[model samples]
Structures are given as structure tokens and as C-alpha cells.
Target: MEDCLRIAVAQIPVTTDARANGREIRAAMRAAAGAGARLIQFPEGAASGYPSGAAKAMLAGWAVDWAALREELEEIAALAAELSLWTVVGSSHALTAPNRPHNSLYVISDTGRLVARYDKRLLSFSELADWYAPGAEPLVFEVDGFRFGCALCIEIQFPEIFVEYARLGIDCLLLSSFSRDPMFAIQVQGHAACNAYWIGFAVPAQCGDAASSGLAGPDGRWIAQAPQAATRLLS
Candidate 1:
């Protein structure tokens, strides 16, 4: 068992263009490698961009190319293998119609394998509830000696999920969110303090007023944070 692990929280802007998002992800992976981080986490919808209400409306007219999205994901996995880094990133997973896709987190191992996937269990009533299907199972994976659990966006508002992770003996929680509200930081800190575990929060750089991508210790204090509106690698 390793005594310590180095992880990176990548806070970067995401767009509707999957190729552009892929480039950003590659760049973040390189930065994580340079920082000597073995694992990296990216914000929710990092690959597809968290569609706004406006974008959501446009989806009806826009035809989504699932093939291209899959290719981009493959490219990310290749990059992870080249850098020997594990990655946790958010992307949309397609489902058979008339079911909508899932808002999911992909766990890629150092070998570039898609080891696990975590879908957002709790759907927000506002935008996501109509767009995504709720996930029923929890996702937990391990690195070195540390066990990590996954969550997305509004799930932070629920304490039961965090409690479940604590019961499962996770040392850390990886959260990917697009929320720009100041309450985001407060909720995460409270969860960390209450659960007595480390937490990594990742949000898009363009998310105005969003709490910066940061890692908090078991004490619920920030150990590191990215600069406002800047694309940065926080470890």
C-alpha cells in the first residue's frame, strides 16, 4: 500500500465541439504528467460540454454523431496510456431510444483501459431530469491504497450518497460539476468535514462565479485551488 498519492484536478473550458474538448483534455493530461500526478480528474461534461438551456433546445435540430464522440474518447485513452496516467472524466453515454443518454464519468486506467463508469445517480429537476436517465449503482475504484468514489453536479446536494461512500470506506470522493454557484464550495467542504475524507472538486473554467477546481483535505480546508477563470492543473 502506498502512503501517499498525487492527483490533479483539471479546470478548463468545454464546448459543444468534441474535437476541441479532446484537445483540451490532452493538454490537461500532459500538464498532469509534468506535475508528477498519477491520476487526474476533469469537470462534468468535459468532452461534450454541459449544454445550457439554449444548447439543449438546439439539440432537437442538431444531429449528434456518436461515432465521432467515440473516436474522441479513444484518443483520450491513447493519450492517457502514453502518459501513464489514470483519468476520471465526464462524458455522455448513449442509450437506446426512446431512452435518453446518461451523464457519466469514465475511469481510464494507466494502461488506457476503460476500467469503470459512473453515471450520475441523482438527476437535477431543472435541466438534467428531462435529458438524462438516473443511474442506480454506485461507482467505486481504487488506486494504490486509496479507494475513490464518484459523483456529479447536483449530487453534492445529497448527503446520503456521501454517507454511503463513507460506509464503503472510500478515502476520497471525485466530483465533476458545471455549477457556478458559490454554494458549491460550501457543500463540498461540509461533505468532506462530515465524512472525514478528502474531496476533489472540478468545474469548468468558464463557469462564471464557480468555485475554482480544488482539492480539500479531510479537515475540509482547501489544499489547492485554480485561479479564477484560468485553465489550470491543481494538485
Candidate 2:
């Protein structure tokens, strides 16, 4: 691991097709690799729409499809191996025990190995808690000799998580989410700035709605930003 590792933030548009999204992600990873980035981050719930109401049906059936998820994750891992860039992407995942689903974030090594899984800890009161289970584990991974902490979406708002990670000596933080609220986005940015840690805000946006999709550095500045419309955010 190098001391001065460059990380790339990818800004991408979200579509209804998962394969298409995957392809776009693949391209973004390659581009980041070309940019000399050792690690890359992606948006939350990117595997499926950040649905509300009845649209939850879009993610209904695939809890046990670990094999398929592996295949998709492998695409990233292969890229990591070929380009030697560690990757993180948001996902639609299910638990093996009860077959429940979770909004997940995964870190894949350059060799395509699944390093860690962090489920979205905070679910929206309206749509999320009812559909997805609260994640049990905290985010922790190694990149460029630095121990990094990770979270999905709303986790960035709760200062406790950041305190815990900072006390544990985390050097950086990466977050993936699909919240479309600008206020929430600002909250995340503020949290990162106050903590003085490198934070990646990988979140999905609503079509033309007030949304935030971007990356934040330790100084609490926007490193990269995505439009409110369908798009990607890479920093």
C-alpha cells in the first residue's frame, strides 16, 4: 500500500436495467483505474431503483442469489485485479438465514474477493424499515495501508458512528445511499467536515428532484457532485 493513494469518485446515472448499470459501473471502474486511483466508491441502492410505495416489487425475489451477486461483484474484482483498484458498490442483497433483503454496500479486492458487507443501518421510516432489515455489522476495510470505515446512506447523519470509527483510528470513510433530500446531503457533508476524515458520499438521486450525489473530503468540501437527474457521482 502506498502512502499517497489517489481515490476516484465516479458520478453515474441510474437506469432501470441492472446489467446496463453494471456495464456503466464497469466503465467507470476502468476510467478510475486509468486515473491512477487505488480505490473507488459508488452510490447506494444502485442495483435497483430507490423505490417508494409499491415499487418495492422490483427487488422482491433475489435473496439467495449470492452466486449471481458474486458474478456481478467479480466483474468489479476482475477490474480491481486488472487495474489494482479496490472497489465499493451499492447493492440489493438478501440474508441467508431468514431470506430477508438489505440495502448493501460491498468492498471487493483487486482479486475479486468479497472483503466486507455493510447493510444500510438507517432505513427511511416510510419505505425502508418495512422492507429492509437493519444491518448488524459496522463498516471497516483496509486501503492503501489505512483502515477505512464505511456506511450506507443515512448512517452518515448519526455522529455516534463517526465517533466510534474515529476513536478506532479509521483514516477514511465511504458512504453509499439513495436519499434524495438536499438537507440530508448537507448533513452528511457537515459530518465529514467536522470529523476531519476523508468521506465519500455515494448516493442515488431522484429524477429532477432535490437530491445530492457527491463526494466530500475531510475539509467538508464537495469533491464531486452528481445532478438531481439520473446520473452518477465519482470523486
* Best candidate, lDDT: 1
- What would the TM-scores of all predictions be? 0.96, 0.84
TM-score of 1: 0.96
lDDT accuracy of residue 67 in candidate 1: 81
By summed lDDT, which 10 consecutive residues of candidate 2 come out lowest? 61-70
Q: Could you give candidate 1's per-residue lDDT for residues 121-176 as a string of tens digits?
A: 89988545567888899989999878999999899989999999999999999999
RMSD of each: 1.4, 2.9
Q: Over 4 Å off in model 1, which ranges? A: 61-63, 127-129
- Give the clashing pairs for model 1: none
Error of 1 at 192 (Å): 0.5
What overall lDDT, based on C-alpha atoms, would model 1 receive against the true structure?
A: 0.88
Question: Taking the tens digit of each residue's C-alpha lDDT, what string does model 2 give over 185-211?
Answer: 677678778888877776544522565
